[model samples]
Target: MLTKDELCIQKEKPNIKDISLELYKEFSEEILFNQIFVYYFTNGTTMRIEFREWRIYHMLAIQHINGKIGKDRFFSAIENGLTLSDFTINDSIKNRYKIYKERITMFLCMYSALKEANVFYLPSGKVQNTKNAKADYIVFSEIGSKGMNIGLMKSGEVFVPMTILISKPSNKMVYLEDAIPMEVERLEIINIPIKEKEQDSEQ
Candidate 1:
């Protein structure tokens, strides 16, 4: 069997064909996808948008999902997290996700739409990466200076699996995107509102 890297290498030229088509075609019911609205805790909405913008390593650790309706659609947060050691990214889907993941606004739209479908991901019921440059959902990452260090959200208690990364010879995370389902369950933490700004009281 070929290693993930070897399989990823074979996927350089993406074909418009996939085995999932048969399964997708067989689906009869038209399920609705909901767009989860994640109100930021400390960082605020801007911070949530930040992680959605920079596909941080931590953000990629969790499963992200999206869908469309007519010409327009939405995005949402679901409850699911994948471990680095347990993710497997398919070729075509991997490339497609990479293309879409880069677009922040659109990604959020997808995230929101997914909410309509009632999707949400809460790994171990604990969201990490609070120091994320802009905590859209609280998950973030810090690579080398010259390199692109992702800073995204931590919808809930999910960890960005090492699987969804786009492989960089210098940065191995790049090859991890495969395991990251293009339409992964959003990582939205519920019943636990993030606390912004600590109380600053002095005598």
Candidate 2:
């Protein structure tokens, strides 16, 4: 069984490779970087923008799929918070994560496309000053990040295990695009939406 929120999220997960191919053909590095900036790097503290972007994007991806927030609301909040610099930078200090984890969901989408298009990353890690990993991307386990079960085949194809969060655990890799649940009964919540604002107004 899966929750209704999870089902909604599963339906929205995109095909990464297909998106990679399309974006690679039609975009520039600056455009991709801007998406990274607004969605992932805007609210970061104690880290340089260039360094924090990748990790934040990964966090956003995990959190987004887990039903913490939607892609539209996340970016829309950012735009509403920061309307200057033509949205190249965010100026709002408050509401960084209101009803949202870290204002993300577009990190890997743009990352896959940029990597496929040969748009490169900074050579050194910004936080530690060491050389970053020599792979296409690296994963970080931060607060609120979820684990994605992935395996690589000898043929160079990647397999991702797809299972409902609330269902009995299964290590089954049933399909290539297995990030979302395609077959699971959904459970709907029966109450007022649980946000701090709603709770506060009830008193």
Superposed by TM-score, candidate 1 places the C-alpha of residue 71 at a distance from the truth, in angstroms, of: 7.0
- For model 2, how does the per-residue alpha-carbon lDDT over 37-88 read when each residue is reduced to its tens digit? 1112222311111212223323344233333334334443333452212222
TM-score of each: 0.19, 0.19
Q: What is the C-alpha local distance difference test score of candidate 2?
A: 0.25
Candidate 2 colliding pairs = none
Regions of candidate 1 where Cα sits further than 4 Å from its true position: 1-19, 22-32, 35-41, 46-169, 172-203
Q: Which portions of model 2 miss their true places by more than 4 Å?
A: 1-12, 20-22, 25-30, 35-45, 51-203
Candidate 1 residue 187 Cα shift, in angstroms, is 6.7
